[model samples]
Target: AQSVAQPEDQVNVAEGNPLTVKCTYSVSGNPYLFWYVQYPNRGLQFLLKYITGDNLVKGSYGFEAEFNKSQTSFHLKKPSALVSDSALYFCAVRDKNAGNYQLIWGAGTKLIIKP
Candidate 1:
Protein backbone atom coordinates (compact mmCIF):
# COMPACT_ATOMS: atom_id res chain seq x y z
CA ALA A 1 0.00 0.00 0.00
CA GLN A 2 1.04 3.62 -0.63
CA SER A 3 0.66 6.32 1.97
CA VAL A 4 1.61 9.94 2.59
CA ALA A 5 2.05 11.73 5.88
CA GLN A 6 2.11 15.40 6.87
CA PRO A 7 3.06 15.02 10.51
CA GLU A 8 2.29 18.58 11.55
CA ASP A 9 -1.23 19.83 11.72
CA GLN A 10 0.08 23.40 11.52
CA VAL A 11 3.31 25.21 10.77
CA ASN A 12 3.81 28.70 12.20
CA VAL A 13 6.32 31.24 10.96
CA ALA A 14 6.89 34.98 11.03
CA GLU A 15 6.78 37.20 7.99
CA GLY A 16 10.06 37.28 6.05
CA ASN A 17 11.21 34.13 7.76
CA PRO A 18 11.68 30.80 6.07
CA LEU A 19 8.79 28.37 6.18
CA THR A 20 8.66 24.62 5.73
CA VAL A 21 6.00 21.95 5.73
CA LYS A 22 7.10 18.37 6.17
CA CYS A 23 5.86 15.43 4.13
CA THR A 24 6.83 11.78 3.80
CA TYR A 25 5.58 8.85 1.78
CA SER A 26 5.81 5.10 1.38
CA VAL A 27 5.25 3.22 -1.85
CA SER A 28 6.62 0.44 -3.96
CA GLY A 29 8.68 0.99 -7.12
CA ASN A 30 9.14 4.66 -8.08
CA PRO A 31 6.97 7.26 -6.37
CA TYR A 32 5.34 10.33 -7.81
CA LEU A 33 5.09 13.05 -5.16
CA PHE A 34 3.21 16.31 -5.34
CA TRP A 35 2.37 19.38 -3.27
CA TYR A 36 -0.75 21.51 -3.46
CA VAL A 37 -2.22 24.51 -1.72
CA GLN A 38 -5.89 24.87 -0.85
CA TYR A 39 -7.89 28.06 -0.60
CA PRO A 40 -11.46 28.79 0.25
CA ASN A 41 -13.86 28.26 -2.71
CA ARG A 42 -10.89 27.52 -4.92
CA GLY A 43 -9.88 23.99 -5.79
CA LEU A 44 -6.49 22.51 -5.03
CA GLN A 45 -3.76 24.46 -6.76
CA PHE A 46 -0.82 22.50 -8.08
CA LEU A 47 2.45 23.54 -6.50
CA LEU A 48 5.15 21.20 -7.77
CA LYS A 49 5.80 17.57 -8.57
CA TYR A 50 8.68 15.12 -8.21
CA ILE A 51 8.49 12.53 -10.93
CA THR A 52 12.12 11.94 -11.80
CA GLY A 53 15.43 13.74 -11.89
CA ASP A 54 16.26 16.76 -9.70
CA ASN A 55 16.04 16.06 -6.01
CA LEU A 56 15.17 19.73 -5.53
CA VAL A 57 12.07 20.90 -7.37
CA LYS A 58 10.83 24.49 -7.39
CA GLY A 59 7.19 25.39 -7.54
CA SER A 60 4.96 28.46 -7.71
CA TYR A 61 4.90 31.28 -5.13
CA GLY A 62 8.63 30.97 -4.51
CA PHE A 63 8.18 27.55 -3.01
CA GLU A 64 10.42 24.54 -3.48
CA ALA A 65 10.70 21.01 -2.18
CA GLU A 66 13.50 18.58 -1.46
CA PHE A 67 12.91 15.03 -2.53
CA ASN A 68 14.90 12.48 -0.52
CA LYS A 69 14.32 9.04 -1.85
CA SER A 70 16.38 7.33 0.82
CA GLN A 71 14.36 8.97 3.54
CA THR A 72 11.11 8.80 1.62
CA SER A 73 10.48 12.49 2.24
CA PHE A 74 9.50 15.54 0.21
CA HIS A 75 9.48 18.64 2.40
CA LEU A 76 8.25 22.02 1.12
CA LYS A 77 10.36 25.12 1.70
CA LYS A 78 10.04 28.84 1.12
CA PRO A 79 12.86 31.23 1.87
CA SER A 80 10.69 34.23 2.75
CA ALA A 81 7.32 33.77 4.29
CA LEU A 82 4.44 36.10 3.58
CA VAL A 83 1.23 36.74 5.48
CA SER A 84 -0.71 36.03 2.32
CA ASP A 85 0.97 32.64 1.96
CA SER A 86 -0.96 31.26 4.88
CA ALA A 87 -3.10 28.38 3.71
CA LEU A 88 -3.67 24.65 3.97
CA TYR A 89 -1.04 22.59 2.20
CA PHE A 90 -1.33 19.01 1.09
CA CYS A 91 1.12 16.31 0.08
CA ALA A 92 0.09 13.62 -2.35
CA VAL A 93 1.41 10.53 -4.09
CA ARG A 94 0.20 8.71 -7.16
CA ASP A 95 -0.95 5.14 -6.74
CA LYS A 96 -1.80 2.90 -9.64
CA ASN A 97 -4.43 0.31 -8.90
CA ALA A 98 -6.13 -1.97 -11.36
CA GLY A 99 -4.90 0.01 -14.37
CA ASN A 100 -6.10 3.32 -12.97
CA TYR A 101 -3.94 5.93 -11.29
CA GLN A 102 -5.26 7.77 -8.24
CA LEU A 103 -3.84 10.32 -5.85
CA ILE A 104 -3.44 9.52 -2.19
CA TRP A 105 -3.42 12.76 -0.25
CA GLY A 106 -2.31 13.68 3.22
CA ALA A 107 -4.61 15.05 5.88
CA GLY A 108 -3.23 18.61 5.48
CA THR A 109 -1.05 21.17 7.21
CA LYS A 110 -2.22 24.71 7.90
CA LEU A 111 0.52 27.31 7.55
CA ILE A 112 0.33 30.48 9.63
CA ILE A 113 2.52 33.46 8.95
CA LYS A 114 2.44 36.46 11.28
CA PRO A 115 3.97 39.83 10.84
Candidate 2:
Protein backbone atom coordinates (compact mmCIF):
# COMPACT_ATOMS: atom_id res chain seq x y z
CA ALA A 1 0.00 0.00 0.00
CA GLN A 2 1.15 3.51 -0.81
CA SER A 3 1.12 5.89 2.12
CA VAL A 4 2.56 9.10 3.50
CA ALA A 5 3.39 10.05 7.07
CA GLN A 6 3.66 13.56 8.47
CA PRO A 7 5.09 13.10 11.92
CA GLU A 8 4.46 16.63 13.12
CA ASP A 9 0.99 17.68 14.12
CA GLN A 10 1.98 21.33 13.97
CA VAL A 11 4.97 23.53 13.23
CA ASN A 12 5.36 27.03 14.67
CA VAL A 13 7.60 29.53 12.93
CA ALA A 14 8.26 33.20 13.31
CA GLU A 15 7.47 35.41 10.38
CA GLY A 16 10.58 35.69 8.13
CA ASN A 17 12.57 32.71 9.38
CA PRO A 18 12.91 29.66 7.17
CA LEU A 19 10.58 26.75 7.82
CA THR A 20 10.25 23.10 7.01
CA VAL A 21 7.55 20.45 7.17
CA LYS A 22 8.69 16.85 7.00
CA CYS A 23 7.16 13.88 5.26
CA THR A 24 7.96 10.24 4.53
CA TYR A 25 6.39 7.67 2.25
CA SER A 26 6.12 4.01 1.31
CA VAL A 27 5.09 2.79 -2.11
CA SER A 28 5.51 -0.05 -4.57
CA GLY A 29 6.93 1.85 -7.54
CA ASN A 30 8.30 5.25 -8.43
CA PRO A 31 6.00 7.61 -6.59
CA TYR A 32 4.55 10.91 -7.65
CA LEU A 33 4.94 13.13 -4.61
CA PHE A 34 3.26 16.43 -3.96
CA TRP A 35 2.80 19.16 -1.37
CA TYR A 36 -0.41 21.12 -0.93
CA VAL A 37 -1.46 23.98 1.29
CA GLN A 38 -5.00 24.59 2.50
CA TYR A 39 -6.43 27.71 4.04
CA PRO A 40 -9.40 27.88 6.31
CA ASN A 41 -12.51 26.53 4.58
CA ARG A 42 -10.66 26.44 1.29
CA GLY A 43 -9.42 23.72 -1.07
CA LEU A 44 -5.81 22.71 -1.30
CA GLN A 45 -3.43 24.73 -3.41
CA PHE A 46 -0.52 22.96 -5.08
CA LEU A 47 2.85 23.73 -3.60
CA LEU A 48 5.27 21.46 -5.44
CA LYS A 49 5.83 17.98 -6.79
CA TYR A 50 8.54 15.39 -7.35
CA ILE A 51 7.88 13.35 -10.42
CA THR A 52 10.99 12.34 -12.37
CA GLY A 53 13.73 14.90 -12.10
CA ASP A 54 15.90 16.95 -9.79
CA ASN A 55 15.72 16.15 -6.12
CA LEU A 56 15.14 19.78 -5.24
CA VAL A 57 11.92 20.96 -6.81
CA LYS A 58 10.61 24.49 -6.33
CA GLY A 59 7.03 25.67 -6.40
CA SER A 60 4.57 28.41 -5.67
CA TYR A 61 4.87 30.98 -2.84
CA GLY A 62 8.63 30.54 -2.50
CA PHE A 63 8.37 26.92 -1.43
CA GLU A 64 10.48 23.93 -2.40
CA ALA A 65 11.04 20.26 -1.61
CA GLU A 66 13.75 17.65 -1.72
CA PHE A 67 13.02 14.10 -2.77
CA ASN A 68 15.19 11.56 -1.04
CA LYS A 69 14.78 8.24 -2.77
CA SER A 70 16.91 6.22 -0.37
CA GLN A 71 15.00 7.46 2.64
CA THR A 72 11.67 7.45 0.84
CA SER A 73 11.10 10.97 1.94
CA PHE A 74 9.94 14.27 0.46
CA HIS A 75 10.25 17.16 2.84
CA LEU A 76 8.90 20.62 2.05
CA LYS A 77 11.06 23.67 2.68
CA LYS A 78 11.02 27.43 2.38
CA PRO A 79 14.02 29.73 2.55
CA SER A 80 11.94 32.25 4.50
CA ALA A 81 8.61 32.02 6.25
CA LEU A 82 5.71 34.41 6.28
CA VAL A 83 2.74 34.99 8.55
CA SER A 84 0.51 34.61 5.52
CA ASP A 85 2.08 31.23 4.93
CA SER A 86 0.47 29.87 8.04
CA ALA A 87 -1.96 27.16 7.07
CA LEU A 88 -2.40 23.41 6.77
CA TYR A 89 -0.02 21.37 4.69
CA PHE A 90 -0.62 17.91 3.31
CA CYS A 91 1.78 15.50 1.67
CA ALA A 92 0.58 13.08 -0.93
CA VAL A 93 1.73 10.28 -3.20
CA ARG A 94 0.16 8.63 -6.23
CA ASP A 95 0.38 4.93 -7.00
CA LYS A 96 1.16 4.45 -10.64
CA ASN A 97 -0.85 1.26 -10.91
CA ALA A 98 -3.75 2.48 -8.80
CA GLY A 99 -5.67 3.64 -11.94
CA ASN A 100 -7.12 6.89 -10.66
CA TYR A 101 -3.92 8.71 -9.76
CA GLN A 102 -5.87 9.96 -6.79
CA LEU A 103 -3.32 10.85 -4.15
CA ILE A 104 -3.03 9.04 -0.87
CA TRP A 105 -2.79 11.91 1.62
CA GLY A 106 -1.06 12.49 4.91
CA ALA A 107 -2.86 13.69 8.04
CA GLY A 108 -1.60 17.25 7.45
CA THR A 109 0.62 19.53 9.50
CA LYS A 110 -0.71 22.79 10.78
CA LEU A 111 1.78 25.64 10.26
CA ILE A 112 1.60 28.66 12.53
CA ILE A 113 3.66 31.74 11.87
CA LYS A 114 3.96 34.43 14.48
CA PRO A 115 4.27 38.07 13.59
Identify the candidate with maximal lDDT.
Answer: 2
Collision count for each candidate, in order = 0, 0
lDDT string, candidate 1, 8-115, tens digits: 999999999999999999887678889999986678999999999999999999999999988999999999999999999999998544245888899999999999
TM-score of each prediction: 0.94, 0.95
State the lDDT at 110 in candidate 1. 94
RMSD of candidates 1 onward, in order: 1.4, 1.0
User: Model 2 over residues 44-80: C-alpha lDDT tens digits?
Assistant: 9999899998999999999999999999999999988
Q: What lDDT would each prediction earn against the true structure?
A: 0.92, 0.94
Index of the highest-TM-score prediction = 2
Which 10-residue window in model 1 sums to the lowest lDDT?
Answer: 94-103
- How far in Å is the alpha carbon of 104 misplaced in model 2? 0.4
